[model samples]
Target: MSTTLSSRKRKRGLSDAKQSDSLSIELSSLSDTQTGPVLASFPYLTLPKNTPFNVSVRGEEEGKEFVRCSSTIAGETDAIEFSGSANDGSDGAGSRYFLALHRPGSSKLILQPTPVYLISRQVKALKNFKPTEPSSSEHFQARSMLGKVFGTKKAKAAIDAQERNKIDVSAMEDVVGVLQDRIDEGTENLPTQEKLQDSANAARLIPAYNADAERPEDIYPLHNIIPEPEWAALDSLLSKLKNAADDRSRVRLLPNARSDWLRQHLMLAYSSPKPKRKIAKMLIYASVMFAFRGVAGRNVPERSALLERLSPAPEVVVDGLLARFTETPRGSTKARMTSENETNLLTHLFSLCLKVDDYATDTALIASDLKMSPTRVNDLFKSLGVTRLFNVVMTDQLMFVEIASGCTIGKLSSQDLKRLGLPDSVGQEKRAILKAPLTFPKPRLRRRA
Candidate 1:
């Protein structure tokens, strides 16, 4: 009986040894064989204390160039490592293999032959897992461990020389004077217009404007405040007023209700504690009739009262002058622009130059300098006139001029310019220039027998 027991024991020992050898061989095979190349990876990013990013597998999908893992990494979690390649088209029409980090204890990257969702059924169970307060010190300690290991030290950002320099806003002729200084220094030493408020800043930055003073610069800031609906409504109303056959149609066009709305809107824009000149200008210039009418009646006693609170826009003044200059009597061959009309136009231009950067540029002057044809210069002027607030009129004299806003005439005069703070010297200069016979259109001499 003892011999039989010994034989059974020997057999059991041999069987156990065989099982151990097979398990060892399987382990060796797994360690030696690589499934596929690592596809995508992100460097381990340090997180703030007690803060963590959540990572979750979205889904698997085929992409145009590569198989999109569709995994989204977001949330409050500790440091995570993700490295994997799930590409089936390795041989051809696939992403070229890349050198990968073969670091010890890295993420276990799997390359499944087919696209598949990675999240398991156990994740659904986690959805119902209610978070509880720390019942034990171990839970608290584990949470706190992350803060100690991966907290980042943030250094204050250094301010550069450009950032340290405060914006120097010098209004009037000072803008041009500074611009000229910068240009004279050298092209490489030009000042940057970083955080520049308006076109005045842009003008100072541009070397071309500083080089030539008379050039009509695009100093006006672009305002695309009007929407399509509002523009259409305005245009429609304007067209009706223009084509109105009789006084009744004209009266209908300028109804009392509409006038009231305009007056209120204008006052709101102009009388704000800190009035926006641009907004006020936009409201006033919506229609020619509205702008010329000005706020009237019991609500406003004197024109001086309105003028005191709100100044007339340069745009309105210029537009009105252009309209007057272009307006002709029914049978007249010459333009109906008066001596005052010429003076106002000149005064506005002179005043504009002193304020805005290179606000006045002579493109025609530039064309003439470049030896461009007269016809070409004229065409250029027309194109530029549409884009610019004003154009340069170079006949006998160099004058910065904006074309009429529309065919309709305006009531703006020299009296308006005086209210707008035009100096007496500028008005006198304009009058003298206009009185010169060469400045005016010469009358045709009649052929006698």
Candidate 2:
């Protein structure tokens, strides 16, 4: 009896193990039986497969048509029928549609008109919201603005036509000839060479706003302060210095003749027999002014030397700079000493002060004198190293650079001098201590004697 029971128990255990294994296999096969790869999906749309199929979508949102895609395998005929859920002949909400392709078994994709439908709907709404006609006054105002910038619509049309066709210069010859002919018939005489030259010069001369863009030769700041001949001489001196290879080279290239002329004026200004000699005073003034201009423009390196010889007396230097406030430089014949030229010359003189350090006054006050804000004054001083604020700390034998730069100091990386408003001559060096003796100073007790 015991042996029979043992055989039955072993058979039952093996049968139970086989059943569990079969169940696990069936579950895995069922999980694997899913649709093919998904192509794309969005909030309202998805492409499940890149095969022969049809798409049907219909919906509406906020008076705008919405599209929903329902895909199906293709059939014998490529045509797919679409029927809306709305019976009132108007496509409504809660619609169901299917897209079928040509083959029943083979999968192929059919492009939908959803994008076109949305674009057309938007365009239609925009057309309805836009005004059909604008008021006459508003139309004219808009037309005037357009005409000022780009001429009338008719002119723009003509330009567009010209651009569409190849442009032939020969076509303009006839128009030019017609204009010249009309001018000749209307006038008794043609403009003379002198008049033509004058016209050309008038056109070539830039407005004061664009003075910086003009060539250095064309900048005319000395016109009123110095006579024409004196102005020409001074300009020549500056040009010679500017053409030098560098600032040091510029100092060597200074014209002795001009310096002598300048010195004579300075002597005349201080020790001449005639104290009120206006010509001598003007010459002295011009010399100082031109020197300031050179320094401000970075075209001369000996400006500080020139200032020293011009006026050893700081009071005289301050007085001379102040007097310029009243003296006006010549501008266009109609406007003597225009605001633009005055501001430019004043700015140059301000920059020259930083280079020379002639004025002992506070920088903020100096900026006020120059008609500039204190911040701008500090910026200029930092850039030229006039204040020595950006200097690195140094000891007798060792240099300690917590921060070093051309412009500003920091504990880490170096930065541009300009950004820190510092002169480029400033630099930084990194160092590391190799080793040091671990010795301590010994203190000696007072001797008993």
Output the number of the TM-score-best candidate.
Answer: 2
In model 1, how large is the Cα lDDT of residue 323?
Answer: 52
lDDT score at residue 158, model 1, on the 0-100 scale: 21
Q: What lDDT does the true structure give each of the candidates?
A: 0.34, 0.36
- Estimate TM-scores for all models: 0.18, 0.22
lDDT of 2: 0.36
**Model 2 spans > 4 angstroms off:** 1-22, 26-345, 351-365, 368-415, 418-449
lDDT (10s digit) by residue, model 1, range 1-449: 01111122335545554332111111112221222222333344544566433433333333332223433333333333223334333323444333323235533222223222122122333656888777666674564455445544321122223234546555445578878877887765643443232353233211112211223232222222222333333444444434556434443444222443344444444344555544433333332323222332113223344333323323333234235323455885434444444333323322232222112223333333334464443333222221112224454444444332110112223763465445545443211011001121223333332
TM-score of 2: 0.22
Candidate 1 Cα lDDT to native: 0.34
